[model samples]
Target: MEESTINSSILGTKEYWENLYQQEINNYLDHSDPGEIWFGKGLTMKMVKWIKSKSSQLLPDDGDQIKILDLGCGNGHLLYSLYQQGYTDLTGLDYADKSIKLVNQMASDLGIVNNLKTYVADVLTLYKSNLIPERIKFNLIIDKGTFDAICLNPDLDLNQVKSDYLATLEAILFKGRSFFMIASCNWTKDELINMFTKSSQSFLSLYDEIETPQFSFGGSKGNNVTCLIFQRLS
Candidate 1:
């Protein structure tokens, strides 16, 4: 059976995010505006709270000890929140240079530049590239909407893209000791499970999940967003 696909959108394109972040940079410089939060501040905080609640289970020894990577970190809102919670080793990576610039600008303004590091790199091709050194591995990887954006790109082959993404995760995550948390509105809980776990080389397994508010219509209930956590199983 052919799997259903989400309609391709401009949101998937690098050019779109680059342009958006460029404008955000201008906005920040002129008006002191921070920029757009991908899912919203409330949801971002909710995610941080969830992590806080599970800190004992998630962190290696201390909150400052574990390295956290914000994949597709646009404007660094999520990392900023995590920083407030006392997670010191925070890195934000994005494909757009403007996105990195905006993150750096915000970090500088907040005087948290030393706590956060922003880099420009494509997540999809990251595993194949030497941009992020092999010696570096993250304890926690958070993806707010990066996978959704990757899936929405019209030009790419979905299967290959997903393979590359999972491969990248396998490469960067601290083997047998790391966790990956992702929040998505584009995929259902089951669909996401199938997508990540079905691959033959997949080393990730479902760990825990957080439920969002559900809406009812026509005697059916469904959530507008899905948040899930996965652990790397070696």
Candidate 2:
């Protein structure tokens, strides 16, 4: 990990995303779609459709409804999209203060003043956060680029980061009902499947796959992103 400290994304850190939202927040107010939607709105809408079709399975009717946590939530665009689709039990967590501020502003501006909660909390240290209630467990946890950033960090500690990340997730998921939805431009489906199924430190089971768009990028024959769903087994 020390050797990876010199990489580009590591060079920017949370500061880059903060500056990005600061400059683009006003622009987002006018535009229907904005920057680095991580693959784009097309894929996001595809995810929306997938959720719409699978809501009963994902949310169930146990009377608890559905609770979702957006890890490294950035500006909360994913939560906003979910909100537009009429799913309201949402919470977003980010390490950057500015990102949380922007997410709250985005929610308030959209008149989603009460349904969404955004918190500033480090994913790597999430278990220690007092912002979230101890008894609450999420029905779904989502990640767009959080893992990519974690793996790219200059200070990355494989053992500590992986342990903390998985521990926090395990602590938050509702037994028998919670799962994780991860979308990434940094990993392939096989790679992700193996990471959870084969990794000695991981306890996730492959629940399903979210079909991703197939498109060429950098002359490749596949999409730049991969979407995967994993359920907690422990």
lDDT agreement with native, every candidate:
0.89, 0.77
lDDT of each residue in 1-234, candidate 1, tens digit only: 357589899999999999999999999999988788887777898899988898777676544477899999998889989999998889999999999999998898899988887779988889989988888889889999999999999999998888899989998998877899999999989888888777787898999997677889999988888999998887
> Weakest 10 consecutive residues, lDDT, candidate 1?
56-65
The C-alpha local distance difference test score for the whole of candidate 1 amounts to 0.89
User: TM-score for each prediction?
Assistant: 0.95, 0.86
**Segments in model 2 whose C-alpha atoms lie over 4 Å from true places:** 1-8, 26-35, 215-222
lDDT of 2 at 161: 63
Predicted model with the maximum TM-score? 1
lDDT score for candidate 2 against the true structure: 0.77
TM-score of 2: 0.86
Reference-based lDDT, residue 143, model 2: 86
